[model samples]
Target: MKIIKLNAIDSTNSFLKEMGQNSTLKNFTVVVTNNQEKGRGQVENKWISKPFKNLTFSVFTKDFDLEIKDQKYLNFAISLAIFNTLSNYKTPNLSIKWPNDILSANKKICGILIENNIKGTKITSSIIGIGLNVNQEKFADSLKNATSLKNSTNSKYDYDLDDLLLEIIENLKNTIHLLSLKKYQELETGYLNVLYKKNIPSMFKDRNDVLFMGKIIGISLYGNLQVELEDEIVKEFGLKEISFA
Candidate 1:
């Protein structure tokens, strides 16, 4: 793995994507920054973190040859990798929110954004951007839902940043290997087992802003969320179609 460390940057994902376009970055090439300005998550959500207090990085993967139909497996694999890393740290209540957000005890601790390079119907490469709240203590009022490892655990983390980064990469390597071997069912099963709020009733808002209660059954093969609404009706909703209430 090639690692690039930056003191501050606009966005690690943007940097690595630009690099991937200009050069043949090796598989697992990582670009991490102490501070990320203008960092983004799914649906243009801004990720805010104090400089040098979190894990903000992007990784480039190449030549994976993943099928478009099974692309969500890649998302599950990456989420599982981060989940495993945090679980090792004894992070309380680690769970994967729908579409790959990492939560701890009902608070968000990590976000992942994956961009793929596709040729015809196969994914040739991917840029996996991750923003993990590590040691930050205070957050802006607008980020009330955000928490970090230090804040969640009530103890200071003295581990090196690269140590966690390398650990995630190692797990990612194993996941990618599974994808290469077409182990889709196994990966999906592992993902659902740790899925947040699965089989539990919760409140959600539909795209029209209507509030309703539903139970998460399982995600569809294409990664759409399946919710069993009142009256026992199950429906699938894609990204942006639903949000926690």
Candidate 2:
């Protein structure tokens, strides 16, 4: 349960990955930064980090079955962890978007990126990178979809970075421990309940630039997104083949 707090770092996820690669790191070991120089999101999208204003951290976990491609559940796991942490602040508007984005009143409150190092069925480690807009006052023009807790509360949501990390790390540990016992059906159901694109037929941009107005069915074990086409055809796709509008 050790946390490596940094005044600044290139990327929390990158740092944690390197840490695992260098040695045998324990589960729940976390890397946190008040300032990140380069933060990457899904599809190589850049996460604009505002120093001391946002929460950027990553946790290393070795407690997962690593089966069931429903990697979406992992997203559910981490989102639940964050949700449990933030919900304690009396923020009832906080919610999670599908595929792994946290939102407060439809504006992005945080983003998650999951990475894993696998050797066959054995995963040496998994990195859960999270970026939460905790205290930022404003975002750049490009991040118009983002919001922060400070903005939501109209009061300073600032806290000691070390303390915040400890809270999130504990939530993460408990989450994984439960999942280790196959007790994630409830969280997974909760995540799907709040999906941003549930039952709505919307245009999605696939990896090859293909567009489809499909309704999401659910997620497969491998984390492949299951979408039901308008023509009543069911198609499942991996991460390379899907993203929200």
Candidate 3:
């Protein structure tokens, strides 16, 4: 449970990786920054936050004993952990968008990027990077959908980043233990229970920008999204195959 705090860094994930390369880091080792110069998001998207106004950190965990085929469960567990943490803060209508985006009342509040190091067919380690909007009040026009904890709660609140970090790490510890204990069914079912837009018809766009309406059925074993369309047609879409419109 080694924690490293940085005044500023290019990317906490990269920093943690370099640290791991230079020396052995214990499980649950964390690197947090008050100012992340270049934060990353899912699928190479950029995560933007005002300096010292949000949460940006990465966690290094090892000995998952997880097969490469079941890596989605790791994502599920981490997502659930973040969701639980936010819910504990009384964030209203918390839901996880597929593949690790946390939404609050349909507005984006958090983003996660998980990179795994594999040895043979099993995962040897995972670098879980998280960027949670906490106190930022203004967002670029390009990120019109983004919102923060203070904005959502409509308060001039100042949060102690270390306190929130502690809470998140605790949640991750519990979830990771469950994962190692082979509580697959419980974690997977719990993930689906909080899945955003589940069983509700919503607009989605294919990579070609063609829009269609579908209801999210469930996630496939391979971590693809299963959607049932108007003609009773069901299909599974992986990352970048589909997105909310």
Candidates 1 and 2 compared by TM-score, better number? 1
Model 3 quality (TM-score): 0.97
Worst 10 residues of 2 by lDDT: 66-75
Best-first order by TM-score: 3, 1, 2
What is the lDDT of every predicted structure here? Answer: 0.90, 0.78, 0.92
| Candidate 2: residue pairs that collide | 68-221, 69-221, 69-222, 69-223, 70-221, 70-222
- Estimate, for each residue in 143-212, the C-alpha lDDT of model 2 and write its tens digit: 8988877787677547565666678888887777766776768867877776666677989888778777
Off by over 4 Å in 3: none
What lDDT is reached at residue 157 by model 2? Answer: 45
For model 2, how big is the CA root-mean-square deviation?
A: 2.4
Ranking by lDDT: 3, 1, 2
Q: Which one wins on lDDT?
A: 3
- Cα lDDT over the full model 2: 0.78
- TM-scores, all models, native as reference: 0.97, 0.87, 0.97
Query: What TM-score does candidate 2 reach?
Result: 0.87
